[model samples]
Target: MTIPAPTHQDMLAISERLGLGITEEQSKIYAEVVAKSITTYGPVAEISAEDTPLRPAGGSREHTVPTAEDNRHNAWFVRSSITEKSTGPLAGRTVVVKDSIPVAGLPMIAGSNLFEGYVPDFDAEVVRRVLEAGGTVSGKAHCEYLCFSGASHTNVTGPIRNPWGDGYSTGGSSSGSAALVALGEADMSLGADQAGSIRMPSSFCGIVGLKPTTGLVPYTGIPSLDAEFDHVGPMTADVADNALLLSVLAGPDGIDPRQHGVEPSDYQGALDQGVKGLRIGVLKEGFEVPGTQRAVAERVRAAADVLARLGATVHEVSVPQHRLGLDIWSTIGWTGMTETALRHNGIGIYRDDHYPVSLMEWAHRHGSAIDQAPPSVKLFFVISEYVTKHIGYAGYGRGVNAARVLRGKYDEILKDVDLLLMPTTPMTALPLPDPSSGIEDELRTSHPMAFNTAPFDITHHPALTLPCGPGDNDMPVGLMLVGRHYKEATVYRAAKAYEDTGEGAFRP
Candidate 1:
């Protein structure tokens, strides 16, 4: 590929767009200098154009969009069988990967029409790890459009239904990942979290979802909303399976810049250790969030009490700063999405991480079509653009600083407790938004479920959601256990003890 030099007229147009006020003569001079400077890009373009070893090494596999009968809940985007190893820990297990992550030869729509038919040439690091661990890549699970929603209805494919209830949402943007696991279509699934995407859906569907400490699992090859909050982890039918999957996925890949001093532990090995002597903090703010149903809060509290019975020291703890987490998350999330999704074609710059060049090109080609996106995505665009145009990066800057304070507050509590317990979502699976509802209603269903789960994403803590019991409307209530950074083992230990009581099972 040859680099194109800007013409004098092109320079003038660029100057006008940037409000540089360059004179015609100045534009001509600048064009000449830019043309000379771009000669250096020839080699760079040449290297990029050449085929690299980054492309997955394998024969192409066939994939099919599931029929309505095969995909009753609209959980699977595409079903395919891809197994790279014959024997390993995950042998004979099927793993459904969230559509947000790239799997070579499979279309990664991320539940958005803008990315429709865009097949990645390389596999995300987590996907490759799954294959190597002997897990079958059963399919690509559908998610919310551009992965922007906390509720399942925003998926362009259609609302993903919770297996536990008819006409109910499977909280998103990892909606399909949780549904597939709950439906027994897959033994485990991989899910990404920016704001409660994994844990929220897992809570709604009665499955176990772990959002590992940020960077515990390398995020290379996955498009990031924001490096600070982006996390990819395991969603499984049980805590043991979740722990097993995390062990396989955690650690630095030498490609993701988000990882720093990662410490991978024996996730599965620590499961049987009961919560004896463990100190558990029940977050008061978690239960007090507005819209939190009394039934849901009571269910989570009962689960905490059960832990106390199992020899764990349980006590109420308050992190008042937690109340401000949602605002901070929104500020950073909207601004980051604007920079990464809107301006940069879902591939942010200023990172040394692996770039999905082909995916970025495909997104760029269809970027103009984002206007046809779902209401939730449009809401993100509007707020992000508004903040950027009026508030500038100052809002994001303040958010980052506030996040540090929030993290400190949680850390202070964690010093006296091994894990913090809370509700994964304020409520259980909500009724799916009506398809005929206007944009305001659609937007309303998007993010309210992430109140508790979003906070840990910003704090970079390892948080896991396991089914505690059934709540209102017979929907599964998710009890979230948050651990210190890189301390997923402690979270699993406590969760396993609770699960052993058989109380984590949904018994509606």
Candidate 2:
């Protein structure tokens, strides 16, 4: 079918929007020219690819058992028993993929009804690797709506209560991933982290979580925040399990483009190495954030001493720029959030970013459900859109530049120390905020959660969080160990050394 030609009125509107002051006569001429160009191009090609193996060695899995309707922790979107290759490192281990990452044949709600009934016909690279490596795909874990909110209370399935017991938060958007692992519902889970999503929930629920160096684990087939900040890694009950999962998940998929030239690592190789002779820098800014509970600080300091006693040298390191991380991250991250949320609608440039085209088209069909997004996402959409309109995307550019400065500050400190140690969160898990509460209360939930964790997302460093010990009210505190880019092996080793001392144990 030939394309419909644009009317003179349509051309006038387009010209006015572009600041082209063409008169009525010029509008007719320009409209014909534009119509001819569109006609020559024919209809817009469907962005969705057919259901076939796109990446080599991308095996499939049988959805043997269907997802259960409900569960104790409200942590899973779909609970099924699935495995393909039965003999590998992760054999017999049950795992959940966060709902934001595709796992073919399963309903990936992404914690929102906006994508109901939208099942992908292909698996995410990480999901494929898990099946091939003999890991069982247990279910889809809950994430915050569109994986935006850091608080666990924002999911459409229901609020993910903390495993530490009632009333407390299981910091999110990877809410159920941490909750399930912490409560022993699953052995391990894959979590995508844009701004501390994996680590925040892990810290809140007292599990071990690693946000690998960006681009280390391919973001292919996962709904993303932005290509620059996207990452996927493992959340588990212990450092050993986390390391084991990373060994399987890390590597190029040959299709992500971001992973094209990247070489993978043997993450399990240095796990048993003691932290002897290692220099650990305790970040000063990490402890100075307002609202940091006294016990949370004391607990992290005590862990630093434990590393010292275990033969690692520990000292204080200051990076003043870190004080600006939240602001810088808010500017860039929220702006990117808006761009990504609307990108499939042709609202922005398509940079060949990793997105499930089929799932997106399904979402488009059910797009009206987007109004059900929580207050946090609504706030982000409104504010990010307003800022972009007023400031013309220059704020995002400035934010990226500021992030580079912050990354340089971290690099300067890392040059003198093997790893940077800090509290994973400024405070232990706080009580879940009332859903009907005012915006001020809702904002309070995430303000202190990612102060330390978000910076690494910006810098693309490998950061791991593990249980340190109980803090105020017996809530668990996390000791975060951050390593240079692609040095997750060193991060794992330090975390394992701490784990060996039995200081980070949480048997809930």
Candidate 3:
């Protein structure tokens, strides 16, 4: 395809919009120069627009949108059987990916109608790794709209129901992934997290979720909210499966800029190692967050006691800066999401990454429809846009600086303690909001649940959420274990030790 050069009239209109104040004669001269300069774009445009054929290692692209009868929880967006290898660590394992990630021929809707029929021509790095490791790709699971909410009701298909109780929230934006794994629909899942998306849902649904250290897992081929905070990791029914999946998914692919010297480790090897002799710190500020239920906090404290009984030295530790995590994450996340994702069509500039050009084009075409998004998505857009226009980049800059201080604070505490323990969420699963609810009701249910988990995301620490016991109404309570950067082995070891007690299982 030939590149179309801008006409002199087009240049004049562009100049006016940019407030360039150029004369008509200058526009004509500039248009001629631009035409010559853009002639070099012809080959680049031609290559980019050309169709790139896909060669999936094991899975078939044939799929179907599951019917209501088959999707009682509204968990699956599309169902298919995709497997490449027959023998490996993940052999015969069913793995469902969150809808936010690309899976070759399946629609990557990201829980929004803006990308209704858009399908990727290639697999995300994680998906490719899953198939290569002999894991069967079951299908794509639905999530919160554009992954903006911490509650589950915002997905376009429907509210993802919790498997444990009726009409309860499953958490977001990895709502479906958690539900499916809990329901035995899949053995494991890959979930993305910006503001505790993976851990929140897993906590609510009583599954194991790990948010590996920032940059430990390559985020290539997945759309991001903010590159710095973006993470994709494993969700499973038990700690061992989570560790197994992490073993396959972690490591750099040399494409994503987020991976900073990341090296995959023997995650499975660390699962059998008990918490004996480890100094586990119970973070005081984690249980002190507002909206934390008394029962939930007590449940986590009991889990900490179990660790102490198992030969680990457990004691309360406080990092006061933990309270400010959400505010700092909000400032950086909102500003980065608006400028990088919404403005740049999910592929921000100035990075060496495998740009999904087709996805970018689709986003650019449907960008205007964002106004019709769900309440949570709309709220983020409004707040982010306001921050960009009125507060400018200075706000985001300060957030980045504050994040450094917060990280240092955690690091200082981590120097004394081998791992930090806390409640993954302040409370159990919230009830699903009614459809007739107004914007305030919708927004209320969606936000404020990430107070405990969001801090680790910014600090680049590894955090794992495992069910501690039943809480109010017999709802599952999750105890989180946080480890130093790139020390997922330690996090998994503690979580596995807790899981071994058979106490995480709720008999309700």
**Pick by TM-score: which candidate is best?**
1
* Candidate 2 local lDDT, 23-113, one digit each (tens): 9999899888888788644343332333344333235444433334346667877777788878999999999989988887777778887
- The per-candidate count of clashes, in order, stands at 0, 0, 2
Arrange candidates, best TM-score first.
Answer: 1, 3, 2
- In candidate 1, what are the lDDT values of residues 1-508, reduced to their tens digit? 4568888899889988989999998988998899889888768866866645354749976789899998899999999999889999999999999999999999889888889878888888888899999999999999988899998887776788888786999999999999999989999999999999999999999999999999899988888888879999999999999999999999988778878788799988899889999999999999988689988999999999999999999999999989889998988898888788888878788887667788888888899988888877877778887877887899998988899999999999999999999999999889888888788788888889988999889999999999998987889999999999999999999999999899779865
Residue 497 in candidate 1, Cα distance off native in Å: 0.6
Give the clashing pairs for model 1: none
Give the runs in model 3 whose Cα sits over 4 Å from its true position.
Answer: 1-3, 46-59
Residue 480 alpha-carbon offset, candidate 1, angstroms: 0.3
List ranges where model 2 is wrong by over 4 Å.
1-36, 39-70, 345-355
lDDT of 3 by residue, 396-482 (tens): 899989999999999999999999999999999998888886888898899778999888888889999999889987888988999
lDDT of each: 0.90, 0.83, 0.88
Winning model by lDDT: 1
Residue 356 in candidate 2, Cα distance off native in Å: 3.1
Q: In model 3, which residue pairs have backbone atoms overlapping below 3 Å?
A: 58-83, 58-84
Q: Weakest 10 consecutive residues, lDDT, candidate 1? A: 48-57
